[model samples]
Every structure is written in structure tokens, then in C-alpha cells.
Target chain A: MSQFFTAAVLTSTVAAGIALATPFLLAALGETLGQRSGVINLGVDGIMLLAAFATYYVALRTDDVLLAILAGMGTGLLMGVVTAAVSVTLKAEQGISGIGVYLFGLGFSDLLFQKLVGTPLPITTPPQVGIPLLDQIPVLGGMFFDQSPLVYLAFLLVPVVAFVLNHTTYGLKIRAAGENPAAADSLGVSVARIRWSTVLLGCTFAGLAGASLLLYDGIFQVNLTQSEGFIAVALVYFGAWRPSGVMAGSLLYGLVGAIILTWKSLGIIPLSGSDLAATAPAVITVLALLFVARRFRQPAALGKPYEREA
Target chain B: MQRPVHRRALPALLAVAALVAAACGSSSSPAPVSSAAAPASVAPAASSSVTPAPAATAPASAAAAASGATSATTLKVALVAPSAVNDLAFTQSMVEALNSIKARYNLQVAISDNQFVVSTAANVIRSYASQGYNLVIAHGSQYGSTLQQLAPQFPNVSFAWGTAGSTFNQPNIFAYQANSNEGGYVQGAMAAMLSTSKVLGVIGPIAVGDAKLYVDGFCAGAKSVDPTISCIPVYTGSFSDVSLFATAAKTFVSNKADVLTGTAQAVVGAIGVARADNLPWFGTQWTQVSLAPHNVVSSQIYNWAPILEQIITEIRGGKLGGATYTVTLGNGGETIQFNSGFNLPANVKAKADELIKGITDGLVNVPQ
Candidate 1:
């Protein structure tokens, strides 16, 4: 424990935490937007898996990182469209439909991967783009600025997402559709359109999250996101549908996960109980959610489909 | 003015289903639910946790069985592995061994890869047994209980499984194991010798079977090389999640580990990290030099042919299982194949050769 407290160890752990947070922050930001618009796509993990595989396959063929990321976003866009159509236009149960989308994404991605790419191969990852002189600033630059472009992209989207959700006419319409769909419809604002937009954007972000995770390791395996998407869904709740809150939740999870990993590496955690220690991030996040649950109220019209009256 | 939402949306949902089904149709691997290939009685073992590989019938072997060209000489074998055939770990080792013996024995082989779900794997095992496959290998320890139930039902078919030495005292049930500890011992000794910082990191996938044996042997061997050497291990608690293994590797690298090694399929992720850090890596189960050509020191390849061939011959000799077989450094079941790519010092290479010989000759104890 004492050795774990060293400055070097702390810096390394925090640096890892920021890198680990990229996927969660990216996914949760999108989810936050979706939830803010009264939509909850439970298949974020599935979307990530599908997108991750697409990104991997594209990278394998083209050796182009940017193209691979686009491929991921495209896969996510398709999945998002599926999710939006099922939940919005089709008026299927959002929870069940989202799960259906997830199952399809999960199974389909795996099927495609096995069929197309039999073995897991390494691909070109997004090289870390350090912010020059800022990166040389002792521990801070390494902790925050010296990360993959995907990480920076994820963090940069927070402010953009916050602006879209809190300011502007589009943001107001989204809040209205989520909070009082009947009123929004009465005002001639298309609830379905707003939701479709949010779901599309959010799911696209989920796709970016998958690409980021792939870039993190530069490899793809079955279910490579490994419930990180599900964790992103949880983070939407942990964040209470705010971009800032989602960022904090993601960082907390990442930090806790990094600490546990650091402990395992340092042999501070016993071999027998290392598994239990590994569960710390999920456990702590869940506990935090429980504690934070009472303070945050969901949108009143959330999860209720708006069927316009004749 | 527009079409009804439910009426219009029905086609969209059907289209989605059709697209998914179409992709699955063109899949090279077997659809997740392999009960499609098995008889009607094989329950739908469609598990969501992991997808099973295709029920691939080895082309030459299948042709031989179809023609009955050499009825007396042909041996039909079915393999039900817990992971991908190309996992570079347990399943791949067995598949390679089976492939090695396939031509020599005129064996017809059928494979059901990625049957990680025990219940699903059990159904595949039973389907193979009922189909009159001469030998069915349920290749995971998790399938032990399933074998106990199914092996009794098929008295004529010989069932084999391992990385374990338990045959459940049932006739027609064969258990085989790899004394992976021996090779692991050699790997750990080599890693310790090669490591400059004397801090070696080990990654394990959930501490089960050979994964546990290999890591335990590694630590013991490392300690033997230098009593004061540090060989701490991190168990990633998953076999499929590459990111977890990568995270474990990054942590190891950050902690000043100059040498790295681990077990199971996802260890590729760790090997990637090792390659990035330019650290020496020891591998097991199958040759991982392809994953990290320059970084890999040597691999402990599980040549299951020696033990598996012994079981096949015993079955031919009218001894239908109820025995355990083990492959070791002594029995030629496991071997150390060093990578020609790495610039290994002559002294270190000689020491590794000596360690292998010492273990093969019972001079070294790979104990925890």
C-alpha cells in the first residue's frame, strides 16, 4: 500500500485511468444525450462490439486508422438507425427493442468477425498526440494531454454535447420532447425527429467509443468492449443525464479500475483475491449510483412513447 | 396522410432479422447454435456468452468416411473445444495435435470450436456421440460433469477431455492432461535469466487448469533461478477480453517488469504490450511467435498427439478408456520451441536446453 502511494505509481495509475476513461466517457456522453431526449438504448455494448469489429476489419484491410474509425461510426449509425426505428417509428418497447438490437449487434459482429477475420490480428492504433510543451509539464501533461486522438476527441465532445443539450433551439426542443412530449408535439416540434437525432448522435458516439477502445489496445476479440458499453449505460444514470456528470462518473470508474489494476501489478492485492479486487470499479460505481440515485430525477416523459391523439 | 406506423414498421423489423440471418448464413464459423447441424434431439445450446465455431468436417477425412474406402483403417473423431480453433492457447494446441495425427491414422475429424458454454458444449458432445463418432473430445474441464452424464449413455464411443487427469472411473471415458508445469518451469527459468531488472510479470486468465499450472510453474522456476527475483502475477478473470489482458500488461510494464509471460488465448493482448515495450516474453499452448516475432523467447507447445495417440491405440486394443493419460517433458507431449527471431545469448540458450533436459530427466521439481 505504501509503495502504491509513490508519486510515480500515482502518475502512472492516473494516466492509465484517463486512457481507460476514453471509451466510457465517449459512450456515456452519447447515452447522456439520448437519455436527455427520453430515449434509452440498452444495447450500447452491442453497438460498441459491432463498431469495434468494423473498425478492426477496416483497419486490417486498409491500414488506415481514420477510415477504420469512420467504419466504426458507420456501423454505429446503422445500429442507431435500427434502434431509432424500433423504438421511435415502430413504437416498439424501447427497453426490449434496444436489447434486440444489442443481441443482433453482439451475435452479428461475432459472426462477421469469425467469417471474415478468423484470427484476432493487431492493427494500427491511433498514435498518441502529445500537446508538445504541455506534455513536458511534469505529471499533468502525461496524465491529460499525452493520449490518443480518440481520447482527446472523447473529452472535447463533452463541451460540444453539453452545449447541444443545454443551449440552442435544438437543445430546448430535445428537453421539451423528453420532459413533456405532448407539449412538444402541441408546439409542432417533432418528438420523434428530436429523438431520432439524439439516438443517432448518441449511438454514433457509442460507435466512436468502440473505435477508441480498439485504438486503446489495437486488437479485437469477441465481445472486446467487455461490458464497457453496459457500464456506459450505467454511467448515464450515474451522471444523471448531464455531460459533466457523465464525465465525472466515467473518470471515477476509470480511476477505481486503474487503482485496483495498479494494486494487482504491485502485488498489493493477493493473488487469491485479485479477482475480487478487479471487481472494485464496477462495485464502487454501483454503490455510487445507489447513493446518487435519490438526488437525480429522470425526465417525466422518459420511456413513454408519445402517441399523438386524433 | 401516411401509412400506419405499426404496419409500415413491421417490414423494417423483418428486414433487420433477415439481414442478421443472411450474415449468419455466409459465416465461415458455425452459427452460434450448432444444434442446427446436430440431430433434432440435440437441445438448442444457443448461448449468448460465446459463439461456437463451425462444425467443420476435415475435407480429406470426411471424404474417406463418406466413401468408406478404408473402413477398417478409418477412425472418426469429433472435437468440442471451449474456444476458437485459432485461440493460440488450449483449443489450438489440441486442434494442431489432432491435425498432426489426422493423416497418419486416416482419421476423419469434425470440429465444434468456441463451445464455451458448458451446457451447449454438452449437447454438442452428446450429438457427436449419438452420431456414431468413434471418439468425442469434450475439450474443457468445465465439461467434466457433462461427460459424467453423457459418457454413460454412449458405451461404444470413447469420450476424452483435458488438461485434466480425471476419467470419472467410467469405462469409455478417457482423460488426458498436459504436464504444462514442466514447460512452464523452463519458460520461467528462461524469462528470469533473460530479464534484466529481475522483475518478471505474469498474466493469467482466471487461474484454471493449465493456466494456473503454467503460471505456478513459472513463478516457482523464476524463484529457483533467483530466490530474490520478483514474479508477481495478475489474473485478468477472463479468457476473451483482450483489453483486460492489455491493461494487466501495461500495469506490469509501468511497474518496471523487464520480462513478461502469461497463459490462455487473450495473452496475445499482453504479448502486444510486451512487444511495444521490447520486453522478452515466454509463451505456452501454441507458438505465439507470429504475434510477437521478435519479442518471444520460446513457446511451450502442447503436442497432444503423444498422449492422445496412446489413448486411440488403447481404444483399438479393446481397452475402452477408464484411464488417464499425461503428456510431459518426459513423455514428449509438451516441448519448448525457441523463436529463431530473438537474439538469445548462447549461454542463456544452453541454460534453457539444460533446464528442459533436467526437468525431462526428473532432476528438477516444478513445485509451487
Candidate 2:
């Protein structure tokens, strides 16, 4: 236990926490955007599964991380179109329609994996790139700056998403569409168009999240996402549908996961009891949700299909 | 509009319910159910005796007798697995072993994969037994209770299960386990000798059964080689979360572990991390060399054909269950396959071979 508290162990655990947070951060940020625009895509996990498989398949064949990521994004975008078609064009209930998307993504991804990559194979992950001056900092440098390029991109998207949600005209239109679609339509905001675009954008982020997770380890398996997509969706509620809040929730979940592993390795928790430790992230998430549920209000039109008054 | 919303709510509720069900069933601990009370009509000697009286003069007994009278018996075996048959981990190991012996034993095999739900598994097991299959192999520890209940119901049907030691004192059930620690000890000894940083890491999926035994043996082997060497083992509390395993591997690497090993299907993630970093990796349950040709050191392969053959032979000869079997390094059931692509030092290779010989010759005892 004494050996586990060394600086090296602590630093590595922090760095791992950041790495572990990347997928959740990316997916939650996307979910935040979708929910803010009055759409809820519960199929985020299924989309991640499909995207992860696509990324892994491309990486195995071409060994090009960029191409693999594009493949994942392409898969996500395609699923997004289907989701929009069902929820936006057909005016299907967003809550149930998203479940259809989720099931489709889950079953289709598993089938494709069985038909194509029948066995688990190893592929090369993206190389780590340390930022010049930032990586030289005392302890923070290694934890934040000395990460894979994907990790940097995921973090960068958070601020970018926050800015887009809070300051842009499109952002205002999205909010209007969610809060009161009839008024937004009367104001010439094109509610359907805004909702469709936001859902697509959200799914694109989910796809990238899948790519990041696959590239982190350079391996792929069925059910690889392990309900992380659901957690990302939950983070949207936990964060009050705010980009910054989502970031906080994602980081907390990721750090809790890393801490549990570190604690078990250090013998702070016995091996037989480690399963209880594994529940820390979910328990914390539930507690956070309970605390925040009373304070935050969801978009008025969230999970409701918007129909133009004839 | 109101009707549509109300109808949609049902599906939305159902979808949430299904997701919750999946999450709950995903990695449930094998429930401990006391073995079913023995029925007075069934004789305990039915499993051990060569020429026992037929306990059930039913159609199932007639079918069994008819099959046994044929010189080339068509041995029908059904396997219930918790994950996909091609998971490339525990399930795949058994599937491959069963496939290898199918043709030689005149076996007709049926598999029910992804039966993570215990109730679903119970139904499948009973279905197979009622269909008069010669042997029903419950391929997961989670199926112990289901097997115990179903084994006694179908007195003529021979049942086998494991990574467990107990046969429930039933004559018709065969329990099989792997002495995995023997191979883990050998791998740890090799890992300790080869590690330059004198720090070894193990990523285990759920600290129980073979996973726990293997990790314990690894630590013991590493400590015996060098008391000062750091042997850190972490359980990810999941058998399917590849991302967690990958993150754990990166943490280990970050902390200066030069040699790494892990078990379960999720270990693909850990092996990927090791391969990318050029760290030596040890594997168990299956050959993982295809995942990392240059980085994988050796794999303790589970060769189940020998045990499968023995169980089939026993069932044919009138011994049904009341017996336990184990696969070990001393037997051909468990063999160490070194990755030919990884260039190992001559002395290290010689030492590994010597250790294998020492264990097989009864010179070394591996602690469980």
C-alpha cells in the first residue's frame, strides 16, 4: 500500500482518469446539444457501437486513424439521418423513436462484427503527442497536455460546443425550437430544420466518441461501449443540458472509475470486494442526478414531436 | 395526437425496461442455490455403477439404451454459454475444444450462446436434457444451480459443468476444472525473469474462480523470483468492458510496469495497449498471439479435448457423473504455447522449459 502512493502512481492515475473521460465527455457534450434542441437520442450507445466497429475495421485494414475516425463519423451520420427521418419527418415520438434507433444499432453492429471480424485482432492506436510548452508543466502537464491527439480534440470540443450553444444565432434558434417550437415556427426559425441539424450534429459527436474509444486501445469487441452511451445521455440531465455541466459530470464519472481501479491495485480495497468499488461511478452519477433534478428544468418540448399547426 | 402519445409511452417504457434488464443480467454473480433435494425414486448409484438398474423406465431411458447399443453411438452434446460462441475468450475456448472432438467422437453438438440471463439459461438446459442429449455441458459457473436442479430430473442424461470442483455428490454429474495456477505460476516466473523494470501488472476480470487463482499464482511466482519486485493486480469488475481494461493497462504502463498479463475476453484491450507500447504480455484461456505477434510472450492454452474425451468415455462405460476432472500442466489438457514471433532470450526460454518440466515432474507445487 505504501508503494502505491508514490508520485509516479498518482500521476499515472490522474492521466488515466483524463483518458478514460474522453469518450464520455465527447458523447455527453453531444447529448447536451441534442437535448437542448428538444431531441433526445437514447440510441447513443448503439451509435457508439456501430461507430467503434467501423473505426476498428478500418484501422485493422488500413492502419489509418484518420480514415478510421471518418468511417466512424460516417456511420454515425447515417444513423443520425435515420433518426431524423423517424423523429422529424414522420413526427414520431422522439423518446420511442430513439429506442428504435438504439436497438437497430445494437443488433446491426453485433451482426456485422460476427460476419466480418469473427475474432479479436490487434491494431495500432494513435500515437501520443505532447504539446510543447504545456507538457513541461510540473504535474498538470502530463495529466492534460501529454495525451493522445484524440484526447485533446475531445477537450477542445467542450469549449467550442459551449460557445456554439450560448452565443451563436443558430444556438438561439435551437433553444427557441426546444422551448416553444410553435413560437419559433411563427418567428420563421424553421423548427424542423433546426431540430434535424442539432440531432445530426449530436450523433456526429457520438460517432467521434466511438472512434476515440476504439483508438484508445486499438481493439474492438461486441458491447465494447458497455453502456457508456447511456451514461452520456444521463450526463445530459445531470449537467442540466449545459455543455460545461456535461463536462463536469463526465470528468467526475471518469475519475471515479480510475480511482476505483487505483484503490484496488493499492490494496485499499480488497480484491473480493472490488465489485462494490466498481459501482462508485454509477452511484455518484445517481446522487448527482438526484441533487440536480430539483434545480434544473428540461426544455418544454423535449422528447415531444413538434407538429406545425395546419 | 393524444392516442399516438399514449401508444408511444408504452414502447418507451418497454425499451427502458429492456435496457435495465440487460444491465442487471450482464455480469451477475453466479447465484448460490443449494442442490435440489434428492428424489427417493432415483438411486444415487445410478451414476457410479456400470450396470445399474434403470431408475426411469421412460422413453428417455429407452432412447439412451438404444443409442448405447449401437457400436458407433451418436453422442449428442448441448452447451450453454454465457457469451457469444466466438468471443475469443472463455466461450470460444470451449467451442473450439468441442468442435475439435466432435468428428472423432461421433458427436452432434448444439450450442445456446449469449444466455447471460439465468432464467433463460435454465430453460435452455432443461430443453436440451428433455430432448435426450447424451451429455449436457453447462459451460459457465452461473449455471450451477440450474444444472443441479435439472441433472437430477433427467437421471439418464449425463451432466457436466465447471471451473467448479463440486459434483454435488450426484452420480450423473461430472465436474471439470483447470489447474490454471500451474500455468500462471510458470508465466509469472517467466515474466519476472524477463521484466527489466521489476514491476509486473495483472488485469483480471472479476476476482474469482480461475481469474483469482491465476492472479494469486502470478503474484506468488513473481515474489518467489524477487521479493522486491512489484506485482500489482487490478480487477476491472467486468468481463466485457474493453475500455476499462484498456484504461487499466495504460495506467499500469504509466506506472512503469514492463510486463503485463490479464485474463478474459476484455483482455484484448489490455493486449492492444501492451502491443502499442511494446510491453511483454502473458495470456491465459486461449492463444492471443494473433492479437500481438511481437509483444505476446506465451499463452497458457486450455486444451479441453482430453477432458472432453474422458467424460464421454465415462458416460459410455456406465459412469454418469459422481466424478470430478481437472486439466493441468502435468496433463496435455493445459499446455504453454510460446509466441514464435516474439524473440525471447535463450536463457529465458530454457528457464521456462525447465519450470514446465519441474512442475510436470512433481518437483514444484503451485499454490492455489
Candidate 3:
């Protein structure tokens, strides 16, 4: 317990928390965009799985992080297009269709992995790039600045996402599409187009999220996402579909996860209940949702497929 | 309007169906490849009377002689694993063991990996048995119930499954388990002695089966070295969540733990964390030194070759089941492999060696 109070321990915990949060942040921010446009994509986890495997495969073959990331994003784009085609163009029920996408991603990724990489092989992770002056700052520097390029980009996306949603014509159309797609359609906005684009954008971010996770550990296996993708989608509701709120929710989750682990390590939590301690993040998420559910107004036509007049 | 909806929906649904069919097609294709490699000599009736030549027969002669006139009597074994054959963990250990004894017994080995789903595994197990394989090994504890039900149906084929001790008292079923606590004790003793902060962390997959035994033994071993040494054991409640493992490992490091260890496949994530912090890591189930040579001090490798040999010998002697095999320090079934890359202290290595000897010699009784 005394060890938990030390400066070094606190700094590392913060750093670890950020590392854990980055994947969720990226995925949730993407989900936020889609939800704002009224297309709910529950297939984010599937997207992440396929992207993670694709990214790992490319990185293993080419040894180029750029190409690997592009491969990951490309996989996501492919999956995204499929998802859009199903829920948007085909007018299927969004929830059930998303599950289909999830199962496809899950099974397809496993199949591809078994066929391509039958065994676990180590790949070099992208090297960490510390900020010049910022990394030298006592505790905060190491916690925030001394991270991989992916982490910096995930955080950067937060503000970029917030600005776009509030201040742009495309963002306005997306919001309009979600809140009242019929009205948006009446005003010459293509509701289908807005929803399809938003879903695709969400999936692309999900793909990037997968690549970030693969880069973090440098290994891929079956179920590597471990439901982080599902949690990211849920975070959309937890954050009220707002980018800033999503970031806060993601960080809270990351920090809580880090704290529980740290507490268990220091014996601050009893060994007997360690399994229960692992459930801290999920329990907290549920409680946060319950607290905010009453006040939140989700998009009116979030899951409805828009069919323009014939 | 209806026609347009139908046209768009048809192509989308067809695309999804085609993709799903491709996945199923690829996953199902491995089964036939395994079944196709089945030896021609394994007659359906011979499976019931699979009594190999006496143990005194030179095992090398068996392979050569079997290829000639005795091919009808050669052992054909099928292994169904829950994960990839080369997961570098539980499944891999059995695969390597099977490979080791393949040539000596004139054994034809067939492997079905990634059988995480029980129904799929049951079908595969039954398929192997019905195909007249001499011995079918279900290499996961999750398959225990399935094996219990299936073992009785296949009276002619010898059944082996583990990471467990129960054989259902069946005549044709063999059970094997590792005395993992023995090696865990040794690892804990070394970590206790070498930890600079007197803190050690154990990232367990779940508190059941061998995982529970290993964690209990590890804590006992640490306390034995220094009664006050802080040994924290945490179960992530999952065996596949690499992110959770990494988080747990980082937390341990953050709390000033200079030594860490974990079990199961997820330990790869924990090992990566240990490497990043330059902390010493102890491993179990397989040799993990390859994963992080610089940080992995030692690994308790599960050498199931000896056990496999014994099982084969018994099957040859017409004694199929009603027994259990345990891998311990005394038997060559489990051995602690120290990493040459890690600069372990001389005294710490000596102490670890002494502990191993003591456990093997019955002077040390590891906690259950």
C-alpha cells in the first residue's frame, strides 16, 4: 500500500492507463460520429478483430508500419462498406445486421489466422517516440508525452472530432440525419448518404483502433480485441454520444482498470476477491450509464434505415 | 419501391452468405486433411484389439518393422486441441509431446486445433474414434465431460484427456495431469530471493484447475523464503484477454514489484510488460524464454513426452485405463528451464536448483 503512494508508481500507473485507454478512445470517438448520424454499428469489435489480424499480417510480411496500418484501415473500410451495404442500402434491422457482421468478422479473422499464421510468431512493435521537451517534465511528461505516435494521434482525434461535429456542414448534416432523417431528407439532404458515410467513417476509425492495439503488443491471436470493441460501442451511450464526453468516459475506464490492477498488485485488494476486482470497469460503466440514462436523449432515428421517396 | 428494396437486399444478403460460407469452408477443410492422412492399415476391427508388441521390443525396431509386415499393428493417435497447435502454451505442449513419440511408435498423428467450441470438439473426437484411431487424446480440461460421455461409446479406442486427473474409471480412458505446483514453488522461491523490492506479482488466468494450484504453490514458496515478502496473486478472470493481462502486469510493476510471473497463453502479454520494465519474469506451461529472453528468468516447462511414452507402453501392454499419470519434478515430465540470456545471480540459481532437488527428493512438500 505504501508503494502505491510513491511518485514513480503513480507516474507509471498514469502512463499505463493512457496506453490502455487509447484503443477504446479511438473506437468510441468513431462510434460517436456514427451514432450522431443515426447509424448504430455494433460490429466495431468485429472490425477491430479483422483489422488487427490484417495489420499484424502486413507488418509481419512487409515490416512497414505504414503499410500495416493502411492494410488495417483497408480491412476496416472493406468491413465498413459491407456493414453500410447491409444496414443502410438493404434496409435491414441495424441491431441484427450488426451481429451478423460481428460473427462474420470473428469467424473470418479466426479462419484467416489459422490459414495464414498457424502459429504465434513475434513481430517488432513500433518504437515509442518521446516528445522532445515535454517528455522531460517530471511525472506528467512521462505519463502524457512519452508515448508512441499512435497514442498522440488518438488523443488528437478527440478535439478534431469535437470540432467537426459542432462546426462543419457535413457534421450538421450528420446530426440532422440522426435527429430527424425525414426532415433532413425533405431539405434535400441525402439521409442515406449521410448515414452510410458516417458508418464507413466509424468503421475506418475502428480499423485504426485495431492497428493501434496490434502495435501495442506486437502479437495477434484469436479474440485479441477481447471485447474492447464492444465496450467502445457501449461507451457511445456512456458519453451521451459526445466526443469530449466519450474521451472522459474512455479515460475513466482506462484509469479505473489501471487502479484496480495496481491495488491488487499492492495487496490493497484482497486476493480472495481478485476476480471481482477484474469486473470493476464493467460495473462502473453500467453505473455511469444508469446515472446518465434519464437525462440523455439519444438520436430519434438512430437505428432506422432511411428510404428516400421513390 | 418494393422491387428496388428486394434487388439491393438480395445482393447484400448474398454477399454476407458467401463470406460466411467461405469462413466455414476453410475451417472445416482441416478435418478432412487430418482424416485423409489416416494409415491404411488401421482396420476398424483392429482398434478394439490394439495390443502392440511387448515393451521389450526395441521401439526403433517397431517403427521399421511396422512399415514392413507389422503396419497393421502400428499405433494411430489423434489429438484434439482447444487452441492453435503452436499457441506456445497448453495445446503446443501436447503437440510437441505427440511429435516426439511419433517416429518411435510408428504413430500416425492427426491434430484438430482451435476446437474451442465443445460441440465441434466432440464431433472431431468421435470422428477420430470411429475412424479406428488407436488412441484419441482430448487435450483440454473443457473436454473432460465430453470425453467421459464419448469414452464409453468407443470401447475399442483408448481415450486420453487432461490437464485433469479424472478418467471416469473407464477401462479405455487415461487421465494425466501436471504437478504444476512443484515448478511454481521453485519459480516463487527464485523470485522471492531475487526481487529487489521484496514484492512479487502473479497474473493468473483463472482460479481453477492447474492455474489455482500453481498460484497457491507460488505464494507458499515466496512466504517460505521471507515470511514478510509481499506476494500478490490476481486472476484476470479470463485466459484470452491480452489487454487485461498487460494492464495487470503494469499495475504490478507500478507497485514496485521487480519480479512477476503468470500462467496460460495470456502470459505473453504479461511477459511483454515485464520486458518493458526490465523486471524478471517466471513462466509456466511452456518455455517462454523465446518470448522475452532478457526478462524471463526461468520457465517451468511441461515435458509430457515421458508421460506419453508411459501411456503408449501401457496401451501396448493391453492396459488402457483405470490409472492416472502425473508430471512432477521427480519424473522427467516437468522441468524448470532457466534462461541463459537473463543474468540470474549465481546464488539465486543455486538456491532454485536446491529447491528443485529438495522437492524431487521428498524433502520439500509444495502446498496444494
Collision pairs in model 2: B171-B321, B171-B322, B172-B321, B173-B321
How are the candidates ranked when ordered by TM-score, highest leading? Answer: 1, 2, 3
Q: Kindly list the per-residue Cα lDDT of model 1 for residues B257-347, writing each as its tens digit.
A: 9999989878878888887778898999988887788999999998887656555555555556777767777767788999999999998
Instruction: For model 1 chain A, give the 10-residue run with minimal summed lDDT.
Output: A92-101
Question: Where does candidate 3 stray beyond 4 Å?
Answer: A1-6, A127-143, B1-4, B25-71, B74-76, B117-134, B149-158, B170-172, B223-226, B313-320
Better of 1 and 2 by DockQ: 1
Expressed as tens digits, the lDDT of each residue in A71-122 for candidate 1 is 9999889889988887887776677677667767777777787779887677
User: What DockQ, between 0 and 1, does each candidate earn?
Assistant: 0.46, 0.39, 0.48
Docking class of 1: acceptable
Weakest ten-residue segment in model 3 chain B by summed lDDT? B44-53
Q: Top model by TM-score, which number?
A: 1
Q: Pick the candidate with the highest DockQ.
A: 3
Every candidate's CA RMSD: 6.9, 6.8, 4.9
**Model 3: lDDT of residue A3:** 68
Docking class of 3: acceptable
Per-model TM-score on C-alpha atoms = 0.89, 0.88, 0.87
Model 3, span A285-306: residue lDDT tens: 8799888777899998898777
| Residues B10-56 of candidate 3: C-alpha lDDT, one tens digit per residue | 76677667656654644433353343233544422112112222322
